[model samples]
Target: MTPEEKYELFDRFCSNELSATEKETLTKLIRENESIAKELKLYQELNSHLDTRFTSEKEEEALENNLKAIGNSHFNRKATTKETKMIRMPAWAYAAAASVAIIFGVYFFGQSSPTYNDFANIPELSITERGNTEKNSKNAEYAFNSKDYAEAEKHLLILLSKDKNNTEYQFYYGLSLLEQDKYVATTRVFEKLYQGNSGYKYKALWFEALNQLKQKKYDQCAALLKNIPEDAEDYLRAQELLKKM
Candidate 1:
């Protein structure tokens, strides 16, 4: 489609004005064309930002009236001074200005502080493969994977009691506590794991950093994230998050 037609379709999609057939077509295009998908994502972000920033209808109406008044005054002055025919500003000029505002707004909005959910890529809990055939292990696995952190925490506590030195259990138990906002317990569990030599050492550090992030302790979070080494699995993600901070 032509650029103008594509943008019109984007506008309609944002406004929820697309018919079912048009929606299907747009979905297919988004799947097949990376550029279309990226553009649509930006369009959605811009629309959401605009909606939040200009929530009052009265405010929007006042802004539009002011723009029209300014346009008319400028054209009327030119007509009187130069003896030239007054040319009214087209309605599309207002729309173009709004579009520019949307672009700049999205840019600045993107620069805002990041949240915990933006970086918390929670891995699935799977403890059954390591010769753990207990019922509590199975329940813990299921509950944690299902995102029932409270239930997972209960089962994990029982599992850890039976196998206290299991770093896997300790690490995931920390995650469960973090999910439940038990910050003190969460850090206690992760502190032991990261202080020891185990596969979960760096992983514990990462999650602890995320816990600090959730609590809005940026300094503590950044300190923990800095401890994650270059060879660690979450190193790149930690670096990215540090840049945002």
Candidate 2:
């Protein structure tokens, strides 16, 4: 997309004027293009600065000066706090860009299973004791990040055998199975996590939803996504994916 087109989408996003489909498309576009991401970040920061540009007190002078400084860094045009009118845009939460479309094609335009590439942001492995450099830990970290799920599963099993109560190991083990399309094994792992009281309980539900989504089981996916409360870290992304699905 052209810079102008991207800015238009960015404006619509700030104003909450885009449809859910448009939002998803714009989001995917921004993620796939670094230039667009940078542009959007600059726009949001500019919008945030402009929101506080006009203030009436002497202490407000610092804020106004800060806005000028930001504009100097990010904008090509000149700006003064004394400018008579302020540009206003509707404010909304900026959905994080850490979300990647793991699927091959954008879901906004098609009726296909979401892929592991689009949604999963596998956490970095720091499984062993901080001072320990075990072979299983090193191998698991490398295998998982390299998308070698089979290798990851082998090492993870070794790690889990030694640390049976490690929920983090169990969690990544499930993800490894899921990535390898071991649906039955993956379900077993996540189901155990979902039933336990670990910090990963809610996250297990989110991953199960992704599992269902990858299988095109929209009803099951929707149900799992709905079970996630607003306080969960994945809640916002779950809602966005739910809408697209």
Q: What is the C-alpha local distance difference test score of each model?
A: 0.92, 0.81
Cα RMSD to native, each candidate? 28.9, 29.4
Pairs of residues at least 3 apart in sequence or in different chains that clash in candidate 2:
100-118, 101-118, 102-117, 102-118, 102-119, 103-118
Clashes of 2: 6
* Candidate 2 lDDT, 151-187, residue by residue in tens: 9999999999999889999999999999888888888
Give TM per candidate. 0.60, 0.53
**Candidate 2 Cα outliers beyond 4 Å, as residue runs:** 1-116
**Alpha-carbon runs more than 4 Å astray in model 1:** 1-90, 96-100, 103-107
lDDT by residue for model 1 over 1-245, one digit each (tens)?
Answer: 89898888899998989999889989999999998999999989999998877797788889899999999999998879776335555899779989999999987676577788989988999989889799999999999999999999999999989889999889999999998899999999999999999999999999999999999999999999999999999999999999998
Error of 1 at 96 (Å): 5.0
Which consecutive 10 residues in model 2 have the weakest lDDT in total? Answer: 93-102
